[model samples]
Target: MDGEYEIKKAYASILESDFERAIEWFERAVRLDPDNAAYHYKLSVTYARSNKLGKAIEHARTAANLHPDNESYSYHAGTLEAKQLLQDAEKYIDGHTQPHLAVDLLKQALLLDPLLIEAYLLLAVAYGELEEFGPALQAAKDAVKLDPQHVEANRLFEQYREKLKRYLRS
Candidate 1:
């Protein structure tokens, strides 16, 4: 079969939530068309869903480099990078720097894809950790705006709003 046909089959498998099969087909597609950024991006997503973070990051980075303006690829790469950074920050930090680094990563993720509600929520949490209630509130608001039905976003928005109120009172 053609590379595009294999890629389409991989996508269909992914859509059906058959991650293992998706990975197999996507790998085949990639082997057939190694330079195709879209194939790499699809493979990255499949890898991520399969909890293969290292492979996900590798393919995502390739996709991002090959198609810099592809917002989806950039967002995936930023999300993976943010996750890794957050893990490192949690392990090494004793003070405010961990949250600060999280905030920076979330900011980069948001810049890449403003509609990423998870990024906004993480940014809100990071800002709140730093006692930057204003930015925290704003980030929460953005998260809720992006995904009104997101339980975490709504909870975080209310929490940050209360924090902002307290900060203003003090």
Candidate 2:
């Protein structure tokens, strides 16, 4: 069958909420049209919906690489990358003894998605764990900049600022 036919089948499967079948059809479409960015993007979306982030990131990157001018493709790829990095950062944070590693990952994620308020908030937490109050205050401020109405960001910023002031006084 043609790639178009496969895509139609994939969409139909999605309408039926049969994600596994949709994934199968999308994979077939990708195989048939390896160079088609749209096919790769669709496959990437499907993979993400199925909670297969690794494959989703692979296809998203491929689609963006194949069509550099397509802002939608690049944006999706960057967001996915940022999300994966945030997850890794969260794992480090959960360890409680690896705040430095989480800080690094969170920084990378923020670079990719500067508007990611969650990353900034998590970064503030990591910096606080490391007793780096200055950076923690800055991260909290950034989060507040991204979302002025975020209560947690405001609270963290105030808390870190106080810590930094106390450190300076000593």
Candidate 3:
């Protein structure tokens, strides 16, 4: 079959949630046309869904390098990096030293794409974890602004608003 056919097959496999088959077909497509950033991006998403963060990051970075202005690629890279950072933060939650770094990663993710609602919520939580109520309130507000219907963001925003008001009153 043609490269395009193989690429289409890979996409179909991905849509079907057959990540292993999608990876194989996408790899073949990449081998056939390594310059195609779309193939790399799709492969990166497949790898991410398969829990292969390292490979997902590698391919997402490659896609971003190939197409610097592609917001989707950059967003994918930022999201993957944020996931890794969040995992690391969870590992150090009891140590009191890693939440700051986690907040930094979540901030970077939001910087890359301000529309990332989950990142905003996570950043707010991380800020709250670090006792940075002011920043937490800001992050929560941003999340609520981006996704008014997001339950967590709304809840966090209300919670932080009340807390900040009390803190200021005292």
For model 3, name the residue pairs that clash.
Answer: none
Per-residue lDDT tens digits of candidate 2, residues 101-144? 99999989987888888999999999999999999999999999
Clashing pairs in 1: none
CA lDDT, every model vs. true structure: 0.82, 0.94, 0.82
lDDT of 3 by residue, 95-165 (tens): 66677877877766666566767777877777888878899999999988987898999999988888888
**Model 2 TM-score on a 0 to 1 scale:** 0.89
Every model's TM-score: 0.68, 0.89, 0.78
Q: Output the number of the lDDT-best candidate.
A: 2
Q: Which tens-of-lDDT digit does each residue in 36-109 have in candidate 1? A: 99999989988988988889989999999999999889888978766655454443233555788878766766
Q: Which portions of model 3 miss their true places by more than 4 Å?
A: 69-79, 82-97
- State the lDDT at 58 in candidate 1: 95
Top-down TM-score ranking? 2, 3, 1
Better-scoring candidate (TM-score), 1 or 3 = 3
